[model samples]
Target: MADFPDAAPLATKLRNTLIQYYNIEENAWRIAKKTKDTTVWRKPSEEFCGYLYKTQGIVEDVTNRIVDHIRPGPYRLDWDSLMTSMDIVDEFEENCCVMRYTTAGQLWNIIAPREFVDFSYTTDHEEGLLSCGISLDYGEVGHNFVRGFNHPCGWFCIPLKDNPRHSLLTGFIQTDLRGMLPQSAVDTAMASTLTTFYSDLRKALKA
Candidate 1:
């Protein structure tokens, strides 16, 4: 940990990504500042936590349904249109579309068509299983996020982590898990929740 004497918010990876991707620094400045406490002695900041906190609500407010309807398209919140900074910066505006939205209990109830599954699933190996369905692609992150949610915290891999088919599930940032489950909890939750979910999925699929 380097002590920032000037205590000014030096650029961060997230900010740099925002600038490099969007071209405007100010848009991410507030978030960067909030990301940490360079103001006084502080701790590590979560990757894009402030941004997630800022935009999740915006996205949530815009989200009509948790399932089919994708947003920032011709919908309620055009993230690009709404953000004044996008004009100054590139914003890239990658589509992190909504794939699945349900609680731990409701996961197996969700369905992806068999034809869709056959088309996308690439392989099943010891390390992890890779599926390639027509998902909502977000250019930045390798996978699509559950829209209007707190990112990886809400995203999870369905395969059982300990079943030799997979090692880990989601990729959460792993900052903290106190008040609310942070993004880091995704992998753990995915591993923890997988057995039950997978079994349910099997039964449901057979049903």
Candidate 2:
């Protein structure tokens, strides 16, 4: 929907990343966190670390309703505590927007806030399968927000055919939180934050 100079390439990368999540080598990833309805796995490499999370038991809200709430736009603040603010820089279509997202650093007092712009696109691939990707756009840098390059994240929602009242949600993200913090600290913080985030989401939706 949104037209950008690099939209095509970004979409390709997003698709590839989605594919990678499904094809990730079993030996390469280890369970970092788990709950009754959610599990998060991590695979660390020299350049960047990848996280894959799967959660079921979310109330089967319509695909569009869930997507609207999660997209990096104005509504994000209502559910995401890590997000300080989000502003839409440009909008191309109903399902595509370029937005600037500011997230508080894991260590609020020590680390500065991280900010980046992303070309976010969402589509219903088919009935019962909804996916969206937010790919980093390095061209624009917002004030007071540091750029963390190559951090792309996305999610997929697949409704169960037998029971339309529930769906499986999977999310993947690759980030380079550039800081002096130890790798162990980063991993622990991320794992904890992610688990809490999902738990909070469930509560928000119920409310």
Candidate 3:
């Protein structure tokens, strides 16, 4: 666990904090949402948004292991770090680019360089130094919706109660933004890509 850099300690810290926060189930994300230190309690959308943002690769690692543990492959465990700035799911304001935070009667737009939006975050990978522009596809993050195959129950996409014809993605969402763009551009462009990712995931699942 110690060998995996931020993975071990963060998970441990997250686990403990969650217990104190929810005082219910010890699921991974419920804890994070409670401890976020944001003034307004974060919505589930925001918490998963942030988790998929930070631990972009962890899901695929767990997924691949689950698959490799079940089905072998020359498999690539995908991870993504892009954040969904906001969601206006109702009919009137769908797919609008909402900022990640709304405070002091304003939406906080996370200003960032184009490259950071494309590749890597200056705050994260570069450790406060300016990156020299790595690869072309550095920060372009992706989200996916795959059908379940012989896995757990309770996660199937059940259509909402009011709208039985339309379905809800009860399964989960995952992202993989590594090598998608430049590390420096990650800050500015996360929102649009996130919107696109959500749209794409919904479409993919519906198909």
Candidate 4:
């Protein structure tokens, strides 16, 4: 097999792909779940057999600060509950890097811990900031952690016009947690996890 290509082109492609996903019509998505904090929608993933989930909520922070917390950096590791550990494996530029990270198990360990090496990029969007990432087949799998792949995932943070301190945060997630797992479990875990994500992030930002 040919070697994986450079990160710059791949990063650009991922950014454009995420923009396309973001621009998709609202009617295309079906409601997955709704909570007091967020509403999540799902549609068939274009990259994998799994479903692509879109989560939207109002975050109580500015767009730049919110994107800083969401992207690969110190803020993410400090606050994100599902992320157990992270490291920047390689840096392409100030806005792009390759990060290796591991997520904690979910749903009473039904979904075991998983590791991923992803090319992450943060770019300016029409609305505000877009922090996007795509999994890369790089580095050895850590012991006891299944290697998971994130197709093309990103978070778009746009500052609210009326409340500049608050921003509208939208995310697109399509992760292929490769393993012999039941489909129902995956669906349930994803929806609930995403809902909880908003709550956790809000709390963190407020702190």
Candidate 5:
């Protein structure tokens, strides 16, 4: 049962950080993995010991609809395979809320299931929509799950000017899955998980 004294400042910071990440030059990131539908890039994180991953792909949907499926909501839980469960712990004005969620183990459970409490915000950006969040050190860790921290993670969905039916979906993810896991395992799991995310989302939207 932890809470923020004020959400406005936190929301503002999250939005600004996400905008900055979106503006990062392409040369700063090195390609980590590429799939049929998505490409992932990674760079050393400024805030943590882990790497910040960037994933980009063209989604066959409008910006608003795509954002709906990504933001903290039922649609997200229904589509995101890594997210096993989610609950809204607190709600604030202007599409901001606190979410408690658990992720399934990756890399054949070598990473172990992890839980996080995050302050999530969804807002309009110059391109289209930005959905972002940062982990909070709130609540006691569940006995069965390791506590993980996310550092300034977000997604920007922008509509194509010529083809309004399609949108460019880009994401920035940096998760510190705290535990005794090896760095190599974490790196492999993250890249694989991110690429799978895009394929799953596309299938969900088509369904």
Candidate 6:
């Protein structure tokens, strides 16, 4: 593990988030969508849970390739339609960066463009497993974007023993999309977002 001495507080926060990510139980999640090689699940919470959404997914991909695509700050806009721009605001370690992401609004809806800052850390632990943790920076806010809160996300890639070229890509995200949008609409949008993101990533890897 790399030392982040200058940003010790942020490193501690990231470590805590990683611990929570690992503690999430599979049984607590309900299936939202499933395909031949991909499965997405959601964990419903009470109104006071401080989290509006919690989603998880597992998909097949090449471990290194997927990690490379996801860990880069600028590559996200290529595959994530919701993200219009991403800028690296700071760097603590070689594999850890703080980024600001601007999201596009749904044209027909009341939701406007929002921005969020997150501290992201990536580690290639062991031979074939890549792990990353992202925690929202509640203090950072842009002029035209809403400051995101209570959102902590994680990504992991585990290479398959049966096939060296293949891996299982796992991700978890808990976000509070602050707005008056119906829960049903939010659910649909979240599901579609992940589906489309993975599809685009796969296509990009092939290209």
Please report, in order, the local distance difference test score of every candidate based on alpha carbons: 0.23, 0.65, 0.23, 0.91, 0.92, 0.64
**RMSD (Å) of each candidate, 1 decimal:** 18.8, 3.6, 18.0, 1.3, 1.1, 4.4
Which ranges of candidate 3 are over 4 A from the true structure?
A: 4-159, 164-185
Candidate 6 per-residue C-alpha lDDT over 1-207 given as tens digits, one digit per residue, 9 for 90 to 100: 222335666566655665565567767777777655566687754433433233333445678777877775556678766788888877877878777687787535556777776677776544554445454544536777766543556676777788757766667766677756676666676666666667777777777
Candidates ranked, most accurate by TM-score first? 5, 4, 2, 6, 3, 1
Question: What tens-digit string does per-residue lDDT give for candidate 2 at 1-207?
Answer: 324555666666776666666566677777888877677787654335544443233545665556666776556788888878888877777767777777887755455677766777776654544455554544556676677543556677666677765666666666666655576666777776677777766776677
Which candidate wins on lDDT?
Answer: 5
Displacement of residue 98 (Cα, Å) in model 2 is: 1.5
Point out the worst 10-residue segment of candidate 2 by lDDT: 50-59
Name the TM-score of candidate 4: 0.96
On TM-score, the stronger of 3 and 6 is 6
Candidate 3 structure, TM-score to reference: 0.23
**lDDT digits (tens) for residues 35-153 of candidate 3:** 11111111133322222221111111122122221111122112112322222111112111111111111013233211211111111111111111111221223233111111011
Query: How much is the lDDT of residue 177 in candidate 4?
Result: 94
Cα lDDT, model 5, residue 117? 94
TM-score between candidate 2 and the true structure: 0.81
Candidate 5 lands at a TM-score of: 0.97
What lDDT tens digits, residue by residue, belong to model 5 across residues 109-166? Answer: 8989999999999988876999999999999998899999999999999899999889
lDDT of 1 by residue, 59-108 (tens): 11111131111222332122221111111111122322223221221224
**Runs with alpha carbons beyond 4 Å of true place in candidate 2:** 1-4, 25-27, 45-60, 107-111, 134-144
Q: For candidate 6, list the clashing residue pairs, or say none.
A: none
Model 6 regions lying over 4 Å from their true place: 1-6, 45-61, 126-131, 135-140
- Overall local distance difference test of candidate 2: 0.65
